[model samples]
Target: METNEDKQAFEPKVVAFLCNWCSYAGADSAGISRLKSPANILPIRVMCSGRVSPEMILRAFRSGADGVMVLGCHIGDCHYIDANHRTVKRVTLLQNLLGYTGINPDRLVLDWVSSSEGPKFAKVTRKFVEKVRELGPMAEEMGKSLPASKINVLVEEVTG
Candidate 1:
């Protein structure tokens, strides 16, 4: 018999890429403030979110992360001044591509958080964790496979 504690103890593994100028600082702020954020997230710091590549995201999924997140500075407020543009476009396209490849796009999330927004960091991480928990494990997704025809079609479309 599984108790409520047992049910609530299911912790999904999350890979988070945070920008050093903002999101990483926000994570530090959350830690400093002792905010209630989920422990599932494993953070990797980058100079900018713009540096998060599609390959990196795919690798996270391939490596068994139940969910992945990229957090960066807000548009126009980026320390690099517009570098976040690539982050936005890339993440959007990647989400769509994930769906096309028969993966749940919700497994990835992108957000903006300034260094001062510790509570927001805590809230967003908590929310993402809950969403992924509901989505279950990456094993469930890995168990399913995309049709070869679908892959071929996508490959042809891209190659053309």
Candidate 2:
């Protein structure tokens, strides 16, 4: 049996996809500025948040990420003009899809952080990590019916 202490000790794995021109720089700035953020976040830099497809987010979950975050420039501040607008739409749709698939939609997060907003980046990451920790592990939510192997098989069937 698991004790409350064991539950409290659970640290979730989080993958954060950050846009290169803004959120990524913000995260880096946070590090350079000595602003503390959660160590559980594995940051992946992309050209733009708009480029983060649903498949990539799903793949992160399939690869054992308990939670995923898509961070980009604030609205109207995107280097790619309105790219983050598309990000908003995609992430919202994906959240609904995740809920339908038995995964907690809260496991995925989408937010904005400009290159100069290092403090915001740190704050957002810390909060997200805490939320995921409270949600426990992804496997717990997925249960046995949707194990990694079964998910892969489903993906293959859909894609092929």
Candidate 3:
């Protein structure tokens, strides 16, 4: 018999899209500094947060990511000059879309972490992991896949 304790022990898989110039360096610094970030995070480095499109995020979730994080430089600090501005907008829209698709918007998060803020990176990642753990397994939440026709209608609603 599965107890509540067994369910509470679930560890969520998290995918983090880190900007190459800032968030990735911050994660590296966190490791070098021996800051304890959760092992659940699988980091993927991107040239800029703006480059992480909705399709990529959807793919991550479809591929079994329980949660996704897009971390970038602080506003006005992006190496690409204002690129993260687009990141902010895109993530907001994506979160709404995720909600519409029956996914909890909280499953997606966007935050800024500069290269020098190793401690912040560790703290942020730890908190996010804990939150996802509380949310339980993605497979449980997504028990039934939305039909293709429903997906098409949603796409049209969002795009049209």
Mark the regions of model 2 whose C-alpha exceeds 4 Å error after superposition. 144-160
TM-score per candidate, in order?
0.85, 0.87, 0.87
lDDT of 1 by residue, 8-97 (tens): 877899999999999999999999999988989999999999999999999999898999999999898899999999999999999999
Per-residue lDDT tens digits for candidate 3, residues 1-160, read 5589977788899999999999999999999999999999999999999899989998999999999999999999999999899999999999999899788999999999999999999999999999999888888888856667777987899999
Q: Please tell me which model should have the higher lDDT, number 1 or number 3.
A: 3
Instruction: Show the lowest summed lDDT stretch of 10 residues, model 1.
Output: 1-10
What candidate 3 gets wrong by more than 4 Å, as runs, is: 144-160
Q: Candidate 1: where are CA atoms >4 Å away?
A: 1-9, 145-160
Q: Which of candidates 1 and 3 is the stronger one according to TM-score?
A: 3
Positional deviation of residue 95's Cα in model 2 after best superposition, in angstroms: 0.6
lDDT of each: 0.93, 0.93, 0.93
Checking candidate 1 for backbone clashes, the offending pairs are none
In model 1, what is the error at residue 150, expressed in angstroms?
Answer: 13
